[model samples]
Target: MFPFKMSEGNPNDGPTPQPANPTSPCPCRDDTKGTQRYETKEQEADSAQESCYSLFTVTQKRWIVFLVAAAGMFSPMSSFIYYPAINSIASGLNTSVELINLTITSYMAVSGVVPTVVGNAADGLGRRPIYILTMLIYLVANIGLALQNSFPALLVLRMVQSAGSSGTISLGYGVISDITTPAERGSYVGLLLLGPNVAPPLGPIVGGVVSSKLGKLLDSDYASVARTHGLEVNRVFGDDLRNFPIEKARLRSVFYIIMGASLSILAYGWLLCFHVHFSAPLVMQFIIGATSTAIFTILGALLTDINSSASSTAAASANVIRCALAATGLAVVETMVQKIGPGWCFTIFSGITAAMGPLLLLERERGLGWRNKIYQGNGGSG
Candidate 1:
């Protein structure tokens, strides 16, 4: 069995204990998941000193998930909140709408890159400290955004805001993995995704509504002991962090879902770019949002599974793909649309996503072997 640091009870008893009554709650048992497999008896014995499940109770874990989801909202909220106000900011700065969009590109660019550092730190230094630090950074950036007068200030501060807000995602996944079991992970995934998926559609709507009225605004592990403490570990992902075929672990399950999202993006782009019926684009938005959310949810859960010990780092690396690709795309989208028009633009973007289907399928087939090879190389038995 893949060993998570589960409390096996009294060693003298010879078996993991069970709850006395079928109807009674089991200590440290919850509906979600996390785990690690150790190769040595000494290592396993060391792990046994920790909690059987998570350090936190079911109620505590649920609350942590909810809080993390709430925190996750800030990133999307800040980005979309500024959308409707773009024209106003542009006009006030005596700049073009295009330039205003650059601030967004900058925010996304920083959002993509900052997590590498934050994820590493969270895994090593512990989640609570990192959480408090990032939130403060984010809060200050938000305040600056609310008060900034120049485009430069806005651009710089948005990146600052992104730096603060983006790490929450990686952190949440780590926390989820800490408290959850793989078998029960999906249920918590929905809750974990509540902010990310729910925020986008609502973000712009919220942004549009709020910006129209006011303005813009928003790992794992060290699994064993960290799980027992209801926090992240005070260590890094180790020499093998970059060596694993993480791309395969992350994208394999989502290959078809990506294609679906690509199609959805294409359709949404067509509706928005062309003079389509109002509700048509709205419907496409829903479709695209749902599809994209599927990609995030699936990939997030899978990465957590693969990097059970260093889930935060895994989630952070995943963000690099999601945010970096988005930043790259956003950087060029307007220029592409200007040169080719919406239909062709959507076609190109959709094609970009669709092209991945083959690689991802290959990932699905060979990913396990690749991961095992990494483990074998590291003197670990998969």
Candidate 2:
């Protein structure tokens, strides 16, 4: 499979041999290929094998991975932790359960959007500064939540908490681009997500939300290879990031993943009918957690692979779509259950998810052609 085509060889493979004809003219300046103008996927793969460099020592990388993974615990922790207390919060605020659920909905909706600003800033600014800023916000939000009395205060504080936490996922991916090469990235990313995946089931019982810069080009072997390729580190793919079929490159690696997540969500929904059993729903939550984490982790890696540098912006774009869909689902789920009951309600959602399989098949077949046509329409800069 084309699978982002970033690299396909074993990690130990050597760099591509120097172009016999460096004087043969760079393919990059051509409107058709731009900087990503690889003569073949294997060539890019070889270059990747050669470029897998990192300044961090193995022990240091382990620490950094643990830190990023730990940061992932925040988003879900904030959400799941608050769920068990929903009733108590409603009682304290003298509000109905519906209004408290509105708070939940608001938290998720904000989670969907706040990443745009944080992630964009993380891309342009440095990941370290953004990380510190958001954590401070998270800290303050926690204090405010602890003191919150009114329903509005609770609502606002939850949103603030979401704002502080959600962007970390995007930034986590950006870091992945920095420390790991494509050949070994998937596993490292899985490690980075340990916090997120492990947090969900335990979160309601304890309650907590736990938990990016282009400077990366300076830190790893990618920088060396990018220099050799005559590509700009600031714009890794090129000036026009759209020149590559990025959607295809990313999704190409995760086709089965999309379907697997669909099945898991379907099962999760049906199990929600038995939420009173506690463990039953939590077990399904655990399964869905694993599947969803795989989807995010893989997609994040692919986005980093295709974009202009390994970017937080690219990763944030994926988060925007993912969180938005989730927020929409959360917003309407209660009404759907009341209207049609959980069985019919979730079956419809699952069906919608299943429908994507065929469409993705179509995307796999024609996405490149469609992108090419658009490329022509964009006057070759696409």
Candidate 3:
């Protein structure tokens, strides 16, 4: 409608030049509006650049995607990986666990802000440089963390570490968006999330091993220590879950998940405080890890059900809120433990978690069925 050519006018038509190749640059002027009609060669080439997925075969692409997702996980991994060393870190720094725990609050605070800036920069500067920059920041922070003996140094460096690490998962999502179509996006996202989901449990185990045997050996003999240590529900419901009542099927599961996770949290802190057994906390960590993963997965599905198109925004919003709450929780938890003692402090968190159950139940009662029906009627459109 904007621009059209007349059929090669009959033979009587004035002679016309051959049309230009679309790929080749051919600037044209519209004298009436004084506008240019073509782009430069470089711009055309940029427009023609291949997608991120085009460079690899199917198998290769999967591996690349998985690796990127795994790399993204390092940020979350760093958070928990240091957990087993919390007491050790406190003792080594000659600081209270309360003070050491504030590092977690600082970390989450910085994490909440870093990704917004990093994402905007990624849009402006490209992903590779930012990725490299963040990784260097994290690496340097870890080095400092290992060497520093003071609480303030620990606090400042953890923030720096989060600054470097938090945007990685967002970057992973960007990659999935670049390579995948909507039909396949859900699976890719699930796989990408696996990195974070699995890291919680494994982090503590690895952290424990490294800080204990490995750290001592490195400091002493330099050779004395060399050691290392190391989801099915969706299938049952499958696509059929979409046909069923979304709220009842999905959210009801969350009820159980929150219950289990809350209890695990309470138990973990109780066991540690009482010196029940070292393995007890580890076991609780594993349960919490698994339950938390399930909770997130289900919540994701619920959000998607509500509005698929806004799922990314929903996730980002949730992350920000979660980080903020985590910061608050972390800030208070240490002091709470000091004042009320660990047993009751954990009980309080357990109660907080239990509080969520009733809220979820309320949602289920209010309009869960109606909302699910609306979603279904809409053809699950985003």
Candidate 4:
């Protein structure tokens, strides 16, 4: 029933605005008040603007950017962590330090080369599976290194390890592109720069401890056996068994330690594959691998997202070129360090890598200008 009846001579046949009400039933609402409709074009536009603004809120956008940048850091962390252990590894295996250094060089070479080839594969194959597989490969390689006695085997395994590990770093950028807008991309890009820059100092410190302390522990039993033999004590365990008794126990203990370490690595790898949760230090190297992989993946995704939303193909191509140039410069620096000494090389290269942080800051400032222009042009069209 109508709340108000129209008089026969009412001027209500023409369009008339409804009276504003404090608590009256809205004309926009149905009887149940479960649904409402926008009656004017202005109302629809206002609703859409609010939604867009909500979606691009400063806090949400900053986190998305942060995650992407964190992802990019993994690659450099994973790559640099093993450099300090090269000389110790060489001594343990009775090989020359130069030969061990080649393994490091080869690993770097593989990392640099594999990403270019796999970058396309990642776009086609998707991100999660490739990342899991790469982590597994890295886990296996570390296990192999711990167990292996031969230099050739180590070399080949290092290559395989690097091939798998490097793919995630490259694919991460692409994933970021899928998620972020162009105007917001530079912050994410800056995060990617943090990975390589921050890793060098951290990597070497860990590497130094592992190589020095662990290496000494590993060789202690052998050193003890040599000393005992000079004192006319039997190094051999028993008359029946040909092996040294104390040495055998030490070897068994070594095997147990290696086995424990290997299992920890495997467990983390499985966790990564199955998306299980884990803590660090308990798993040590695996934790490093996971953290590094995750960081790189996140940053890559942010970069990709920004590029996809905001950049033309030409602009994206320019970014790639810039990345390549930076890599080339790094290579030249690395070569100089190899010729001089690692200490000087690392110091200089570390400085260069650190400089990336400031570069990212500058780029982020520039990106804001570009973002405004794009938004203005889009607004003008609308």
Candidate 5:
């Protein structure tokens, strides 16, 4: 600077500053040594900050868990919603209540059994395809049930429906396990269980209202409209009514309505398979079934997450804790259903299920602290 600024020297010339020795600590360091150490400390601080930010971003993950949980709920909703409609079904099909009961039993049995088989398939084939296939089968079976007049046809279709619908539960849990970390698994799993737990009770309530109203409208006993339409009266009630000749116009109208609904559902199912948009009894059933399916899948996924995070010795213990929580939830739902009826059961369950979203935020905070402790321990060991 002196040479450049001085008038006697060349204007472009300047003294060069000496290079600092790489081994020498800067004067800025009070210790006057180990500058590399301070640099490393700064780097570590930056890394830690980045890690903290990454772990804190769990809101998206929680939403994924919720969706998967919702999908899992659909299976139970589809199966149980029709429970209240059984008598109407029996009447319409010219079948005994016992046969309808058998259908219900078969539906339940298949739902329970098929999931185990499909669970393996889900693991092999992956969640998306399995979910699409399951929903499609369900849609087809429902449509078939709506169209078919024969009891045997109904039974077979019902079986197929259960088989396709049941896979959702297990696969849903599998998806959850994929996304969530171990420390945060429990809360999501609990939320997943909440869907189906609520479905049984809510289904019957809606089913009862719809079935009763539909039965009334379809019945020959109604006064003004019955006479207006010139509908025939059968002396026998319920099954006996099926044997009576339904007016051609009335039968055609009913068939049209059923087929129309079935077609709409079929169209929607195709959309779902292709990941396209669709529209409420049809979409509602899918939603409920999907939610239930997702819940079970999330449960399994959360289990896997938990297993991965814990030590081998602690894995069994972790599983026990999870199972206990699940058992407790099941017991609570069972008790509630028994004490207050299925309608309230679902209401309470849904409330609890929805509540899990917030719980995930809390768990994430606690999980971060726990993970820090584990990290610290590992570092100390190293």
Candidate 6:
């Protein structure tokens, strides 16, 4: 009798099986998903430990993403920051308004075209190096633009500026993907996008103020100086402060900011609901805008950290998605408000914003666990 009972007609009934050959590929092992097969559990554990130990901590990674988001802001802000200077530029260059307007066209064209090339380069060459190169190009272009005397110089320099600034947002997205995981990506992505969103409305206001304060410098020196200062500031934080814990440093401020934002949004909604003073709610609107701006920047950076392998393309895809959603939201918001009344409209939005809080927290917890697993080989380690 067989030591081990074998059922009649079973696959093993024909013969006693020999032990699996450790030197040969296991026939029973299905590797369709590309998971590496180790000879033993000990080998797998050692591999995981090595992989985890090489990665940067969550804090360090976030700081890098934050800098990328800051750099990314220059592109969208540049789009509208020049609006107040159009007429000034026309007069300064002794050119027609129509001719000067073509500068905008050229800038927009370069902005769209440059990102694809830069993003691809970033994917292949690495994020930090590509960012520095682009920024340098943008700085040089800005200086030339400030010194320009004719419409041709203005047009050419603007294109150069666009080429330099356009790819930054893409690079920021790539950096985010490098450090973050898919589970917590949404909130981080939302944070990173804040700059572009905030810039649109504030751009004109800032441009008008800057133009008024520095009328002579508007087309002569202000743009170059401002660009230079921004670059210097970014370099300090991005490069000089590389050793600081990024996620911890940045996120510590977020709780208070979010709390204040939530209260302001709620107050704004309540004021509208009760038909109270309009001006108070308007002030609250500004507060909400300011707080939300920071929130979005944080979220955007967090989103990209989850998927590092194809970060550049992911960033590009995200920008397209953001544009589409924003367009759709704008299209429907007015209709929704008209039907529901301003108070209810705001209340609905407030609820939506509030809902994001828990989701963010959940992602944060998951992200921390994921980071620990990646860097520590297990969640049990501190």
Per-residue lDDT of 1-382 in model 2, one digit per residue for the tens? 2212223577567444544565566455555464345566768787766554665666787788789878877987898888898898888888899999998888878887888788789878878999999989999999999987898888899899999998887788778777765534545665666666566675322211211111221123333534554645442222233433334433554556667667766776777765567687666655555455555555555466554353678777777788778777867999999998776787787788678777766764676577678768979764
By summed lDDT, the worst window of 10 consecutive residues in model 4 runs over 235-244
TM-scores for every predicted model: 0.69, 0.64, 0.54, 0.43, 0.43, 0.48
Per-residue CA lDDT of candidate 3, range 1-382, in tens?
1333445758677455544553544455345233332345556656555422244455764786688667777888889888899998888888899898788877888878777677656655766787788889989988997888788888998899898888776666555544543323445555666666557667433433322232122222111111110011222112232333445433544686799889998998789789887888878877776666656655544544443433334444566777888778867988998898888898888888889888878775654566667677989751
The alpha-carbon lDDT assigned to residue 11 of candidate 1 equals: 56
The best-first sequence of candidates by TM-score reads 1, 2, 3, 6, 4, 5
lDDT of 6 by residue, 1-382 (tens): 3334344577756665444553666556678234444446668777666654226665776576567667877887787889888898899878888888788777766766677688778888998899889999989998998787887788888899999998888887776566654323434455455444545676333332332222222112212433443523221112221222223322444566677677788788778778888888878877786666556445444334433555786566555565556556666779877898767776777777777777666664465555556656644332
Distance from true location, Cα of 224 in model 3, Å: 55
Candidate number of the best TM-score:
1
Q: Each candidate: what lDDT?
A: 0.70, 0.67, 0.63, 0.50, 0.54, 0.62
- Per-residue C-alpha lDDT of model 5 across residues 157-186, encoded as one tens digit per residue: 888988887766566567655554332444
Candidate 4 or 5, higher lDDT?
5
On a 0 to 1 TM-score scale, where does candidate 2 land against the true structure?
A: 0.64
In candidate 6, which residue ranges exceed 4 Å CA deviation? 1-46, 197-308, 317-382
Query: How accurate locally is residue 148 in candidate 5, as Cα lDDT from 0 to 100?
Result: 92
Give, for candidate 1, the lowest lDDT window spanning 10 residues. 212-221
Which structure is stronger by TM-score: 2 or 4? 2
Give candidate 6's error at residue 167 in angstroms. Answer: 0.9
| Cα lDDT tens digits for candidate 4, 154-181 | 8998888777666554555654454433
